[model samples]
Target: MYHYDNYDQTLVDERVAQFKGQTERFLAGELTEEQFRPLRLMNGLYIQRHAPMLRVAIPYGLLSSRQLRMLAQIARRYDQGYGHFTTRQNIQYNWPKLEEVPEILEQLATVEMHAIQTSGNCIRNTTSDHLAGVAQDELEDPRPYCEIIRQWSTLHPEFAFLPRKFKIAVSGAQKDRAATQVHDIGLQLVKGDDGETGFEVLVGGGLGRTPIIGVMIRPFLEKRHLLSYLEAILRVYNRYGRRDNKYKARIKILVKELGQDQFAERVEAEWAMIRDQLLLDQAEINRVQAFFQPHPYAELPAEDAILAAHKQCDAAFAAWFRHNSVAHKVPGYRVAFVSLKPLGIAPGDMTDRQMDAVADLAERYSFGEIRVTHTQNLVLADVRQSDLYELWQALTALDLATPNIGTASDIISCPGLDFCSLANATSIPIANGIQQIFDSLDYLYDLGDLRINISGCMNGCGHHTVGHIGILGVDKKGEEWYQITLGGSSANQASLGERLGPAIAKEDVIHAMEAIFQTYREQRLDDEAFLETVRRVGIEPFQERVYGDH
Candidate 1:
């Protein structure tokens, strides 16, 4: 993880103090609600349904044991006893008091964390592969590039107030676990024909009221020009992106209106002007890269005898190992995912006690490091194989040892009507209902690799656009209705899901999903995953089963 230098520390401290003053003024009536809107938003505070929601950034999803403990303390003291991990690799406190938010930000700053750029129409947190450095298939770690962008975009004067919020994701892995294609700008690190590392840049992709897969605007952008090219793109977006309507203000809308070829040309023109001014040097890249060097891994055999024996002896440990653990680049090491999606709990919600326990586990087993996944889960990226059984035992005590990683039960959901004022329907109850309906773990494993993502509204905060089984809540008359989509994904070949006929009533959602599952079981080929079957069979059969007519 990248530790803050003096400059970083100073900037964060100053921002916290400034926000504290702003918050006090707003409360004291020096600034009206209208006047305080942007100021509060810039600091990641939002006036939600019942109380304020404060989003705290976990830059590139990296956290130290001390930082995790700080977050736990904040959750315990300022808001409810739990916090929600979001799809953007951040955490949200849904019940924080408006007056105490400044204190929360101050506490966060002590741990090299902040809420800046987490909300409003500015560059948001830059996210990358959660398993960055240790992934077996990644060409190189993308966190360095993400950190570079974080430094440049944080409180940048020119981009401080863009037309809409801009999101950027970078992935150096062969598999796109970061959902890069759905971001405003997606950068895939790749080597060119000349063997120089560069980025394959994609532009204009986003999910909200509209969903679009990004177009590859630049096949290869040199490493030295990464910052310049990004600046050029932002410049073009800031100039041409619509401000007349909030819905139309995003860069995706600009790219759509201008056409891909024209947008690319405009960005190139802007780049030519500022490329020299903003070109990053080798020294700067090296400086950032130094922070992400490999941890001191012990030399071990390819297989651990003790771990193998435990797996053979303990059925419960074996189940968790099979699902939660992933192969690491290093021998005898594993990257283990801790599932926050239990049967009745909110998909991403973790209690203060659980957070403290996870911090302890990270310190004991994973070199005091933790990474938050885009799927609203946590990861111990460098867990030794020998420590698997003990780690699993501790996680079980905390209710974090759910053996459903990619299965249907491992759902991704957003805080819909329960917390978010923007939501048309409640997402947590729907998610919980679905999980109850499909409670059989054996059945889930039999069905295989299904991603069910539910969003309370069209903001796609839950990433419903890319789930294998995508559900979006809608308002029909005075009641809540649910819409379903099939065959979406955010992996190596990302695609938007196809809608599955008309919306079903809120009560009928579980039944409809069950019908879809029944259809899949009947129609699937040998050992076909849910996504594979959807693509092969198309959406018609599932639609017919769920709706029973047209």
Candidate 2:
């Protein structure tokens, strides 16, 4: 984790004081709701359905055990004993009082954390792969670049109030775990065939009312030009990106309007003019990289008889190992994922106790490094194979192990009408309904690896478009309806899902999903994946089963 220097500390402290005064004025009636709205938004506070939600920025999703403990403390003290981790790798406390929020920020400053740029469209937190520093197949540790972007984007004067929010994600992994393709500016660190490191820069990718996978602007951007090129992209967006309609304001629409070739040309022209004039350079990146140097991890024995025994003795442990464990760069250690989508519980919602348990596990089993993924899961990057059972025991006590890591029941859902005012329907309830239907482990695995992602609105908070079976909440004459899309995924073969038919009512949404899955179960050829079946046999067959019954 990058520690804040005196300069960073001063900025945060000053902002806290400024926000405290703003809060006081709002409470004293000196500032109207309208006056305080933007101020609160800039500080990452949202007036939700029932109360104020405070979004706490977890920069690049890298946090130490100490930071995780601070979050747990904050949740217990200021929130409703829990925090909701978001799709963007930030955390939101749904029930924070307006007056107490400034105090919360003040406390956070002590831990080098703040909510600045977590909301209100001003270059939100730059997220990265959860296993950035530790992934075995990584080209490089992405945290340094993510941190560099964080420093550049935070409180940027020119982009303070853009037409719409901007988001960026970076990943160095062979797998696009950061979902870089779906961001406003997506960066993938790649090693060239000639053994040189560069970036695969994607422009105009985003999710919201409209979803578009980013188009590659530069296939191989030199490491030295990273920051300058980013500045060029921002300059281009600021120059010509739409401000008339919020829906059309994202860079994706800009690229769509002016074809990618023209957009790339414009960016190239912009880069040619001012690449050297940007605030950052190779020296700055080198300085930042020094701050994010990997920590020393203790070496462990390669052979682990104990781990083998646990795997052989416990069927539950075997299932968990198959799903949650991934190879680590180090020989004897592996990365383990703490799945947040345990059955019947709200996805990404964690109690204070559970948070503490995770902190303990991160500190004990793995190195003290903890990471938050865009999928709302936690990663223990350096867990030794020998300690898997002990770590599993601790996690089990916290109800963290359900052995349904990536199955039908392990659904990706958003906090819908329950918290978000923009939501047309309750997303949590829909997720729960889906979980209830696929409660049986055998049924879920037999149904095969399916992703059922739901969103309350078209904002794509749940990343519904990339789901194997995507569901979007719709507003139809004061009633809530859900539209389904099929065959989408965020992987090597990325593609947007196609809609099946007319939207179904809220009551029928879950049933419609059941019909689709049942239809696939009957129609799939020879254990073909859900996505393969959806592609081979189009949405028509599933539509017939769903709409036919309705």
Which candidate has the top score in TM-score? Answer: 1
Cα displacement (Å) at residue 336, model 1: 0.8
lDDT of 1 by residue, 1-550 (tens): 7999999999999998998899889889999999999999999999999999999999999999999999999999998899999999999999999999889988998899999999999999999999999999999899999999999999999999999999999999999988888899999999999998899999999998898988889999999999999999999999999999999998998999999999999999999999899889999999999999999999988899999999999998999999999999999899999999988999999999999999999999999999999989999999999999999999999999999998898899999999899999999999899888765678888888999999999998988989999999999997999899998998988989999988898988988988988999999998988899999989999978888832
Per-residue C-alpha lDDT of model 2 across residues 284-323, encoded as one tens digit per residue:
7788899777667667777688888989999888888887
Weakest 10 consecutive residues, lDDT, candidate 2? 274-283
lDDT of each: 0.93, 0.87
Backbone clash pairs in model 1 (N, Cα, C under 3 Å; residues 3+ apart or in different chains), count: 0
